[model samples]
Structures are given as structure tokens and as C-alpha cells.
Target chain A: MIGDKIQEMFLENQENFLIPAREVAHVQAENNLNHALLVLTKIGFNVIVVLDKEARVSGLISIPLIIEAITGVTEIHFDRLDSLTVGEVMRTDFAVLNDDYELEDLLHLLVDNAFICIVDNEKKFQGIVTRREILKSVNHVAHEFEHRYDVQLHQESIFQ
Target chain B: MIGDKIQEMFLENQENFLIPAREVAHVQAENNLNHALLVLTKIGFNVIVVLDKEARVSGLISIPLIIEAITGVTEIHFDRLDSLTVGEVMRTDFAVLNDDYELEDLLHLLVDNAFICIVDNEKKFQGIVTRREILKSVNHVAHEFEHRYDVQLHQESIFQ
Candidate 1:
């Protein structure tokens, strides 16, 4: 994901941020710009994968919603930052790195899932890796598990 | 942010991701890992700042809330991405950039708040730039406007 790194950008470009299902780019939580440019040129858009019903990655849709739906409306409210989408424009209180953690705990999930979240233990999504792919898998496992490891991978202890 | 470009070891050094509201790290919405590691070692924390109810910038709690609170448990229906927060975890669908647009539309807002807003229009914060800070401010304003051309900024909008 921009010259992979950060555990192969969350384990090999984590499905390029999943955009299939007929190239999604919705516009119905309200606000529409020619159907968000017809779902951004038929799904070649920047971001907008939200599904909603409580969650389904529940947030995304930024490409400035086609320049604030053709600019200057004066709506201003629902907590600014340019008329929030893709289901309240996600960032969903960030963080989510469980590909089975390692890579110095995926470099401490590099914060703000602006990239990284390849979960599977039912956390779902099973894809996403950026912060430039766990800082390129912590320089590829720092050659011999960097300084006697600090992670110790969740210290298991569940096997009884 | 990936050693500011995947540890080429600091791409000629000058990295920037400034933060100081006491080094952030302040979780609450009931996930409490010893009070989030004592608020991430008293604010020297790398990330984890999810605030809402008008506290401003929400979402972001790195290391995936200590790996889903040390391997999920609080009632097995789990995977609320580890009990969300900061107003049910951030990324409230964003796209707010009125720092007077047209810097290639703020360098394509580095494709979605580069990992959650950095804000400016009286929202304050001010220090949060990416797309690698708009490619290092387009090479420091093209080497200080190459001997100056009524310097303020602009080079054919860098390409619409």
C-alpha cells in the first residue's frame, strides 16, 4: 500500500480495502451529488464502504462528498469537519490489529486505523494494513526478533 | 508514521506527527486496562485519544486497545471491535478542509484525513499534515518558490 511494509501493509495489502459488491459509493444517509457521482465513477472512488445496521465497518465516504455536494450550502451542524458519511464517516474510534499479533505488536497498531485491521477471530474485516504496513513489519521482524522481544505475543496462557 | 516512510530509517530525517495535550492516550467507555496503562504512561503515549461529546477529535486508541483488551472477554458476543468508544469509536464520516481549498484540494486530503482529521478552520489543532504533509509541502513550496514568483503559493495547482 504505497510500497508495502507494516506487516505487508496489514498482511499483504489486506484486500485493497475491500471495494467490490458492484463498486460501492452510496449516498443515502442523506446528501447526494448525482448519486455521489454515480457511486464515484462506478466504484473507483476514494472511500465509502459503509453498510450500517449497527456495523459493517460502519464508516467511510470521503472524496469530500463531491466537494460538499456542490459547495456552500450553510448546513453547519451535526459536528463539523465538512459535513460528516459512508455512515457517519468512519474512524470508529480507531485501532484493530489482530492478524495474530507480532511485528512488535504490529508496531503498536500505529494508531488511528487510518490503516491496519486484519482481524479474524470474529472481529471480522480480516484485512487492512497501513501506517505503511506495520512500519514494514517492523523492518521485517527486526532480523532476529529485535532485542529479546517486548511483545511475547499476548503471552497466551489460555491453554489449560 | 512508519518511521516516516517505512524505516528507510527516517527518509533523510524530518518526521512530523506532533501531539501534546499531555501526549494523549485517554480511553474510557469502559475498556480500562489498568486505566489504559495508567493513561499510557502518563501521556507519553504514542496514540490513543478518543474524545467526543464536544471534546473534539475522536477515535484513535492505538495497539488496538491492548489487543482487544488482552484477548477479548466481556461477554462473548464480542468483537464490538473491543467495546468501541470516543462516541462509539470515531471516523464519524469525515471531509472538512476549508483552509481555503485548492492546494490540489489540500493534496487530496491524503485520501481521507490521512488517519483522522488534523483540523484548522477555527477547530484549532493546526498541526496535523499528511500525504506526507502534502509531499512535504510540495517540496517546501518548490524550494521556496524558486527565487520567488510573488511568493504565497501556486504552480498550476500541481495538477487540478
Candidate 2:
């Protein structure tokens, strides 16, 4: 029953359930370009998600993308970086995962993504999950395994 | 004498000695935008460095930047992504490490970089060192410690 309960918990644990959406950084599509850059640099995040008027996920912005924008990679004037808006440079190519999806499904979605947005069944934006957060989960499991092995070794030594 | 030799070897073990720069993917500034994208996708690199005609490190490009460029983030038509050149979009904000720098110096350089370009004393491009490669080195050392501990424990058990 304990194993079954753990399995059930793992299967039912969704993206929003692991971490609050608000903890992740996001900005409005209409926000100024300088503001977006400030959020990204200040937050120390590689990527920032953009939201639409209805609070739906729209596009993603990254540090490298901003660098590209400033350097005229996207044909923008370097001097005008501060004057532009986030919508002017954010990319639509982003991965979004369902908030209610199981852990197994979440892993599959993260294979090619550094982080992914979580959306509800009706496609309402929830939050995001980064590979760093998933790695923390994996570390916790590994620590538990190591602890159990140590206990087993101690028990065997005492028996001997 | 042996300890001094080990310390000398460790200190002199620079970035280029550990990982060759040619192993990393790079492009020239004059390369076609589409060709750069193809190299990035095919090589499966998160970032690609741009080299100048004299083989000096120039700029850096990333997949997200390419995406930003294609999405008209800088106001270009998505269809024209291939018509452009890499020089138009690459950013000059990158860290470069000296090939002769010590391992300790490499650690400091990597604190703010995912990877750093390596160059010899003449400033000629040598190669690169990624966070992944450094992590691998750490893992190898940890593994050696673990193996040694296991061997010591086995010896102790036999003695008992």
C-alpha cells in the first residue's frame, strides 16, 4: 500500500503541484524592452516567458536573444534597444506542457527544452518548470537511495 | 618531490590541455545565416562561436537568437532568415580564457559563463571548455574518491 501510494503520488504530481507558477519569472507582451531586459538580468534567468492580455502564454525571451537583438542580429538598432517593446523581440517557438500532466509526461516534454510553460486544460497559463528544478528532484531521490544503502550496510555490520 | 610534481601538473593543466577547441562547433562571421543555423542544429550545440577572418574569436550565436531573428523580433521577415548573414546577428559579449591559464583560473572564468573560448598566448583561437566538461572532471574525481573508499572498507573488513 505504501508503494502504491508513492506511485500514485508520482503519477498525479503535475507541474503546478511541484512549484508555484508565480515563483517563475514572466512579463507581459506589451512591456518595454528595457523592462524585460532588466527582469531577465536582475532575476538571473536565462529565459523569461511572455503573457498575453488573457494571461495566456505567448512567447519566450532569453539572454542570448536579447544580445542578438542588441547586436542587430534581428536587424534592430543597438541604440533603440531600450525604446523597443518585448513583443518586438520575443520568439513564438516555445514548449508548453499541461499543468495536470504526470511526472513521466513532464520528463518527456523537457527532453529538448531548458524550461517549459505549464498550461491548464483550457490552455490558461499556470507556471513553468526548469531543468534545474527537475535536477533537484532527481538529487533528492539519489540522496534517499544513498541513505538507505548506508543503513543497510550498518545493519549488516551489526549482525556480523 | 612527488607532491610538488602533482601540484605543478594540476596548476599547469589549462583549458586547452583538457579539451581541444576544435572539438567545439564554430562559424565564421561571413557565413550564411541559414548555414549557421544548420550547423547549430546538426551539431546540437546550444551556442556557436563566430570567428574572424584572422581566426580570432569574434562573436557568439545561439539557437534562441536565431529563433528571435527568424520571428521578426528585430523586424525581419521570417522567410528571409536564410537570406541573411551571421555577422548581422552575432553578439560580442563573450568570455575568452587563455590557454596557459591554470585550472584554478579556469574555474573563476567559468563562474559566469556556460563555456569560455580558449586562446593561446598569441591570441590565436585554441578551443573551448564548457560547464559540462568541468562537471565531468569533478565527477571523475568524485568517482576516484568513492572507489578508494570502497577499497579501504573492503580491506578493513578482511582485517576484521
Candidate 3:
């Protein structure tokens, strides 16, 4: 039943989101940032979504990589833009959630990761989800719930 | 008064959207696909939104661009791929509309190009708008309309 709700939620807001999978692909952390840049250049939008060994969500590869790369880092002790690894700059503080969680929880967590990476217990990169999707899904579910409740209440009042 | 509505509409959907100036700036375009690739890679995924010179919304610079670029017409004829401009492979058929269009009109045009490029009469890319934003606006507007009409109807019925 919950899984059914999940699918329903996904459909209601499918158009509302520009998912990462739709936007870009997940790259291995071991890959060099320069290599990711080269590969990502061909990918169109330059975001390197990092995936862990389990393939679950890891971190974001952002434009800052290029900004840092080209302009180099200012805060570094060295007077040089040392080539940063995906590890050096990737945002690991990103938020992630399981699909099983209530859509409400997802909506709140979505504030962190631009896109939430959906994963199984195995931690494999299952699919990404976004705030738009969650909101859309929640709206649909609320509407459906209201309609169902309305009908039920009407029948009860008539009986009463 | 109209300004209020326009601002209201934009303000309403601000929550659902990541309305940052930095979003997708790197990958946006409406010309040669090859050139788009170059620009997008340089910019990276702030989720660059593509626009035509007149500034009409063209299509989004997606991660798939890189994936597609690796093959976007290249597989069939690699030589010609380089010759292509952002316009050739650029997504031309869009579901774009002016900011003045009613939310209902937009929902009806959800044919393709999920994101609408909000443009001026000259058709320059002003901002990338999304269904997610419109829905919130429409819902708020509908509630306001309903409340006003409900009050009016209540007064008229008492007179009757």
C-alpha cells in the first residue's frame, strides 16, 4: 500500500522535477576531478554527482570545481591552486533519505541535497528524487485522501 | 494591480523552485549543440537553462547533453556533429508562455519542454519557469478567488 502511494506520488510530480538522472549521471569517487570535468563537459551541465561504493548518494560535483580550478583556491596555504580531488571539494554534507520514509520527511530533507539519491539497503544508487517530486506527490496524495474522506463522511452522515 | 498579480505569481512559486541566479547558467543555450557543450562544461550544473537570442526559452542544458553529445548526431555522423550549432540539436519545440498567461493555460500546454522559459515580448531568456511554481501560484489564486466569490454569493443569497 505504501509502495503504491510512493508510485502515485512519483507520477503526480514527475513533470515538476529536473532529476539528476535526467540532468546528469553518478560518477565514482575514485575518478579524478579533471577526468570528471572532461567527461562531464560532454555530459552537458557540469555537475559531478558522486556515488559511493554502495552506489548510494555521496556528494555533489559543482561549478565551484571549475571556479576553483580556473581561479584556483584562495584560502589554501600554498600560493597555488592545487588540483583538488572530487574528495577535496565534493559536498558530502548533503541530505539523503530512503524512499520508504514518509513523503513529508523527504520534503524537509530535500532542503539539503538539490536532488535526493534513492537507494536500497544495499546503498546502490537506485534513482534520484527531488523536492518538486515530493511536494507534487504529497499534494496528489492529500487530494486523494480528501476525496476518499469526503465520500466516507458523506455516507456516514447519510446513515446517521 | 497587474504588477501585483505578476509579482504574486512569481512570488508564489518561489518555494518550489531553486531561484538562484547561478542555476544552470553554465549550460544554457539555443544554438549549436557543440558550442552548448563547450559552454555547459565550462559552467557546470548549476542546471544551466538554454535560451534563444531573442531570449525565448529554447530548452534546458541537461546532463544528457554531455551523454547525448558523446552521441548527439555524432554516432551517425561524427564529422557533422562539430559543425552543428546550439540551434540544430537544441530543443526547439517548447511549452513556453509569457508570465501573463493564466496558470490554467500553462497546465494545458504541458505537452513537452517541462520548464517554460519566461520571456519578454522580444523573447529574450529572462528566467526559467517551471510547472511546480505555477501550481503553487494557481492554488493560491484559486483559494483567493473562491473566498471572494463565496463572500459575494453569501451576501446575494441573503438579499434573495
Candidate 4:
């Protein structure tokens, strides 16, 4: 069926889907909120991985978390950024995948997340699988299928 | 064969994928950065819609944009939040889909974006199609296909 074909496609292209850890912007857990904020703004990604001194995945931090940490009852305490650490406010309750994850596994987790952190058996950060990659794979499969079946499944133009 | 079935599934479940505009958080273009930040923090989304007086989508403002706006060469000028308007800092070059967008159109656009804004003929904001919903739809289709084919395509548990 189509599911099997999709699975096959994923298996064939899984290696290219991962954005290597080196390519992803990340911060150490001990880093201050100000530094973390700089990294986030410079990279233009809302969330980034937090790493430990041993190069293991610690957690994830985002702009929202920083905002929440510095917000007070009626005002934002911008001064708090100077005193807080990334580890103090970072979210630890996120999902991660080991090296042996399948395409279905990636698809299942991405239903609720924009990206999935990949880790090794030692809990060290490996890389990330983003929804963009999965969507591209799906698109590629659809196009290939259309060609093979000799049918036009969608309009030629993209959504305006 | 499999691609045809997948296309049919997408067509069948397209209606349930959109998150209505009313349910989405938004701010008027005239709103100050402080108000926009408050809305973003309260809603827990990094980005939100910017609407004009006529309720048409003027642009989008994100936390990163706000950060870029307030940060100077040496320090972050938090006071600028009171002076800046959402319209001045918002990104206006994003892609938008009309009301007539199809499932494939959405999939194609979402390959590069986390979400696509849905607008009307007058360019008024209608709603949003998010990657989360698309992933859910894809998962549902895969499970259905597995059942109909009497095959186990994936392991029982999701990615750990």
C-alpha cells in the first residue's frame, strides 16, 4: 500500500533528513539567560537545545521561557536576565529519539513538536529532525507517485 | 497505488486540519511592542498575527523580531518596547493562502513553514494550517492503511 511505499521512501532517505548537531545552534546549561537570548536572536529559531558540560542533552530553552522567567505580576523584570541561568528556566520535559528511530517514529512525535532532538545511548545530543525535512520527503514521494501513476493529484501552482 | 490512496485520505480529512482564526492569538498593527509581548507571553506562541484597522492581515510579529528591534549594538534597550509599534517591526513578506487552498497546496507550503496563514478574498485573516495538524492527519492515514492492509508498518510505541 501507500504506507509501505512511504515507509520505504523514508528508509531510503533517512540519513539526509537529520540536521547534524554541529549545524544546530545550542547553548550550555550553565549559560546565562542573556547569552541564551543572544544565541536565539542571532539564529532566528525560537527554541534551541541545552547541553551539559559532558556534551549531553540537558534540556531545551526558548524565548517564551525567558519571557516567562522575567515576567512579574504587572511588569517584566528585564533585570532578571542578568541573574538567571539557562538551566534554571529551560524545559526538561521534552521528547527525544535514540539513533535507531524509524520514519514512523519521527512522524508520530512530530505531530506535537516542531522538531525532535536526537540523542545517543549515553544521552548525548546527536542532531535534530525537523518537520520541514519530513514535509519535503512527503512532497517528493507524492510527486514521484504522480509521475508513476500518470495522474495529476494536485494543482501545478502552490497556495497563493 | 499507494500515492493515490494517500491523496484520497488527505482530501477526505482536510476540513479538520484548520485551526480557526478566532482561536488564534492576534494583535492590531497599532498595538505597542509591550502589548504584543504580553500577548505573546500569555498565549505561549513565539509568533502572532498583525491585523490592520479593517481586520486584514498586515503582517506577523515574532519574539525574535521584537528582540532584534530592542537590541542595540551594546545592550538590549527594553524601554523601546513602549515606543515601537507592531506594524513597524512586523514581517510583511510571509506567504499566505486563500480560502480555496487544497490539501496538496497546504502540504507544499508547509514544507518550508511551520504554519500557513489562511486569508479571504479581501485578504482578511481566516485561520491557520499548522504542521501539527498535518502530522496528525498523516499519522491517521498511516494507521488506517495499516489496518486495511493487515500489516504492521511500525513498532507499537512512538519514538522515545
Candidate 5:
């Protein structure tokens, strides 16, 4: 029964695992980097996805990029920090997963990324899957196992 | 009692909270970017600390950095990937926490950083405290409260 429960939680359909994009932190490519960083900080996300003019996936900006800008490591002119847009500072290299992606494949992407960006068939920006969310799901399933294990032990003791 | 537990976990002495440097993924400054990325992938870390010639903390190379390097967005020459070293692309701007740092201060840092580097006053690399580890600790404490609440509810129902 515990094995079945594990299968139900872990091996379930992909639709149940999709974290809605509304729960993720994202910024438009046209937005100022300064404003994006401010909003990103408030959201407490390690990385913020950048969406294009049509709300499609574009790139990502993270705390490290902010630090680089602050340290003058990047070519961003200090005086233009107020005007620099997300498109100029965000790294365009990122993996975009479709709605049909398997949880197993998503786990592989999470191994190298802080979060995975999901998009629809039309390239509409959707929600992201974060390691924290996945871990939270795991902890919930673990509690179920713990509860069932206690009941099993109780029944065994009564029979003895 | 929950407040006391929070205090015990969050306000306790710093020594108990150290995650140990050996547990972190690190690369030498002179190591090639190709090799560094390979090790980083194998270790499944979002970021890898770059150590200098004297084995002292130098900078950090994260997944985003690797992504940038691959995309040729950074100043690093794409043709020199094999010859390029971690030192060429690592971010020198990083916050280092000493052993005496308060958990509150560490939490503040972790709000934006995936992990905070810990070092001795001599600047010797210690370990890193990841957000994942802190969340896991919090979850453990939360379960205790949940168990107590459940038992209380059970007893009240029996009395009724």
C-alpha cells in the first residue's frame, strides 16, 4: 500500500506537477534592470525570468548578474544603470520546457539550473518549476508514508 | 515552545550551522572552463566556488556563468573555451560570512544568494550554507509542531 502511495505521488501524470507561472518571478525584457532587480529582490527568487515583448520566454537574470553589475565586472555603464533594460543584461542561454515535459526530465534540468522555465506550444511564458516546490511535494509524500507506517506498526502490535 | 525552538535553531551558536567546505563543489582558478563545467555538471551544483593558487577563496562560477560562456555573451572569447580558466569568468563579487555571523544576518544574505560562503578570519574557505539546508531544518522543526498539534486534537476529541 505504501509502495502504491509512492507510485501515485511520484509516478503520477505530468499535469499535476506543473507549477503555475503566476507563482514565479518574471520581468519583461523592456523593463529597466534596476527596476527588475528591485522587484526580484522583493520576490525573494534567486533568478528572474525575462519575457519578450509578446510575453514569450527570453532570458534570465540572477543575483550574480546584479552583483556583477554592481562590481563593474560587466560593461554596463554605471551612469546608465537607471536606463539599462533587462534585454541588455539578461543571459539568453536557458532551457525552455514544454507542457508535456516529464517530471523525470524536469528533475534532470533542475540538477543544473536553479529553476526551469516552462512555455506553451505558442511559446507563451508559463510558470516555472523550482527545486523548493519539488522538495515540498516530496516532504508531503514522506509524511503520508510516516503516517501509514505508524498505523501498520500499531496494527502489528495489537495482533501480537 | 515553538518560539524557543526557533530561537534554538536560528539564534544558536554559529558552529552548529556550518555546512562544511568539503561538502561544497569547488574548482581551481586555473582549471579550464570545459573541465570546470564537466565537474560542475557531475556534482550537480548550481554554483562552484573558485579557489586561487594558495587554495584561498577567489570567486564563484555558477550555472548562469557557464551558460553565458557557452552563449558567447560574456567577454570571454568563445574560441578559447578550452584555454579559458575559471578565473577568467568567475564573479569576484561574493559575500563571505565569518563563524560569528548571526543566523539572522545569514538569512538576510540567503534571501538573495543561493548559498553564502563561509570563511575564517584568515580567509580560509570553510563550507557553504545553502537555502535548501536551511529550509530542511525549518521543515524538521515544523513537523514537531504539527505532531504536537495532531496529538492535542486527538485528545480533545476523545474527551468530547
Candidate 6:
């Protein structure tokens, strides 16, 4: 019964779980690795969205990708950071969700990914759903049920 | 009633959720940033543990920290990767859990962290509890509940 309730709650609040695209940090595909690294450092995020000229979701870029790009068989080529663009090394094989995606789809994807990009039918970026948001929502729901049922599910405070 | 059962299940299976330290990637404090980068690139982990000479958990290292160490006010110091040691740049302000840690503690911490290092009283590394593991466990429980109750809580397959 509680499982069904949680499923319903997740489905009903699907829209609220999304971190809108406007609030997410992103870089243009043409930007060099150096610029991408700067964006990652500035925003304190492990990965950032890469957008093409038309504002479509191009790929995802992260520090590991940059490191891999610069690393040679014998040594790291620091100069490549300036020469290589995000488009050249960004990861294209990432998961994306449509507007009609289910909460179960998100839960399954978030198990392997830190976040999932939400795109429209035209592959235009809409927003992101992060593991943190989902965890927070779960914690919130647990607390809500605790209050309604007058029971203790956990002793810890709500996740911030 | 179901909330209580779920809590009991989580607590009873706490140890199963941990990813033992031996499976985790790590670097020594004496290692240079270049070596750290190599380990990260090789292991496909965003962050790696840093150990002191005594094999105690010293800190955590990641690409952002490396980038920050190499970044100057006006330029990026590419040469610092060779010059700086992991000890000079690794982040010390990370969460660590002991063997007696509760499931609630892990769930609360995993909301903000990708993984929480498990350490002994002597600060020796024991294992790690990852967000992935928690998600998998939660999914497993949902499926178990679905099967027992003979209800269709979700339409999707179990998360891998």
C-alpha cells in the first residue's frame, strides 16, 4: 500500500522534481576544454550540458572527458585543452528523457547517472532531474507519511 | 505499517549496501596530480580516495580540485600537475561513515554526496556506501513489495 502511495506521489509530482534548464549551467559545443573546465569549476558541478548553436542538447562534458582528451599514451598533453573543443571530446552517448517520461524511467536512469537531461520532441533542452532532487523528494515523502500515520520511519532530519 | 517494515528491511541489510574499500579507487597523499589524474582516467571514477602513509583516509581528490589547483588568477598553470602532490590539493572536508552507521545516515548523506567513505575508529578505510547502491536497494524493495502484494506498483522493469 505504501509502495503504491509512493508511486502515485512520484508520478503526481514529476514536474516539480525537474531542475529547469535556466537554472542549470551549460556550455556551447564550440567552447574549448579550458572554457568548459572553467564553467565546471565556477558552477561546482561534476558535469555540464553542451548546447549547439541552435540551443539543442549536443552532449555532456565533464572533467574526466577533458582529462581523457589531453592524456596521451605516455603523457598528458596540456596544450590540447586549448586546441580541442567541447564538441570534439564531449560524451554523446548519454541518456535523455522526453516530456512524457515516467518517474520509474527517471529512477532507473538516475541509478547510473548523476542527472538526466529532459528534452522536447525536437531535441531541445528543457531541464534536468538530479539524484539529489529525487532523494530529497523521497525524504520529504517519508516525513509526510510519518506525520500522517503518526509513526517514525527515520530519526534523521530531512535531507537539505 | 509498511513504512515500519521498510525501515526494518533497510536496517537489517545495511552491510549489504556498502561497496568494500578494496573495490574503491584511491591514491596516496605523496602521489603527484599527474598520477592521480592517470588513476582517475584509468578507473573511470570522478573522485578517488587519498590515503596517508599509515593507510588512513586522508581526503578525497577529484578533477575539479586538480583544476582549481592549476588555475591562477589570470591563467591556468599546466605545469602544476607535475609539481603539486595530491596532499596539496585534495579536499579534506568530506563525509565519512563508521561501521555502526545507520541506513538513515547513509541515505541522508548520499543525498549530497556521490559516495560516503566507511572508516574504522582508527580512521582506516573500510568501504564506501554509494548512491547507486541505495537506489538499487530501494528499487529491489519496491519490486519485492509489488510481488508480495500482487499489485502493479510500476510498469517498468527493475532497475539494473
lDDT of each: 0.38, 0.60, 0.49, 0.82, 0.62, 0.78
Clashing pairs in 5: A21-A127, B21-B127
Model number with the top lDDT: 4
Task: Please name the candidate that would achieve the greatest DockQ relative to the true structure.
Answer: 4
Off by over 4 Å in 5: A1-126, A129-160, B1-5, B10-17, B73-78, B145-160
Candidate 5's residue-wise lDDT over B74-133, tens digit each? 232335557777888899998778866765566656645777888888888888877666
lDDT of 2 by residue, B43-66 (tens): 556588898877788899875566
Write one digit per residue (lDDT tens) for candidate 1, span A7-79.
3323444334333334333444444333433454344434444434433354444434333332343331222
Which pairs clash (backbone N, Cα, C closer than 3 Å) in model 2? A73-B89, B21-B127
Badly placed stretches (over 4 Å) of model 2 are A1-17, A73-76, A146-160, B1-21, B24-160
lDDT of 6: 0.78
Displacement of the residue A134 alpha carbon in candidate 4, Å: 0.6
Sort the candidates on lDDT, descending order: 4, 6, 5, 2, 3, 1
lDDT of 3 by residue, B1-160 (tens): 1222323433566555434333536344435554554455455433356654544466655435433544433232334435655545555555666656554444445323345556567665556565455545434433332222211123334466
Compare candidates 1 and 4 on DockQ and give the better one: 4
- Candidate 4 regions exceeding 4 Å error are A149-160, B1-4, B146-160
Worst 10 residues of 3 chain A by lDDT: A72-81
Judge candidate 5 at residue B94 and give its lDDT. Answer: 89
The predicted structure with the larger DockQ, 2 or 6, is: 6
Docking quality tier of candidate 2?
incorrect
lDDT of 6 by residue, A1-160 (tens): 2366557654555667788989999999889998998889777778999988777888999988888899889788888889999999999988899978877777888889889999999888989988888877666554443333332233232231
- How do the residues A83-159 of candidate 4 rate in per-residue lDDT, one tens digit apiece? 99999999998879998886678889899888999988998888999999888877766555433333322332222
Instruction: Tell me which of candidates 1 and 2 scores higher on TM-score.
Output: 2
Off by over 4 Å in 6: A1-3, A11-16, A143-160, B11-15, B146-160
lDDT of model 3, residue B160: 64
Clashes of 4: 1
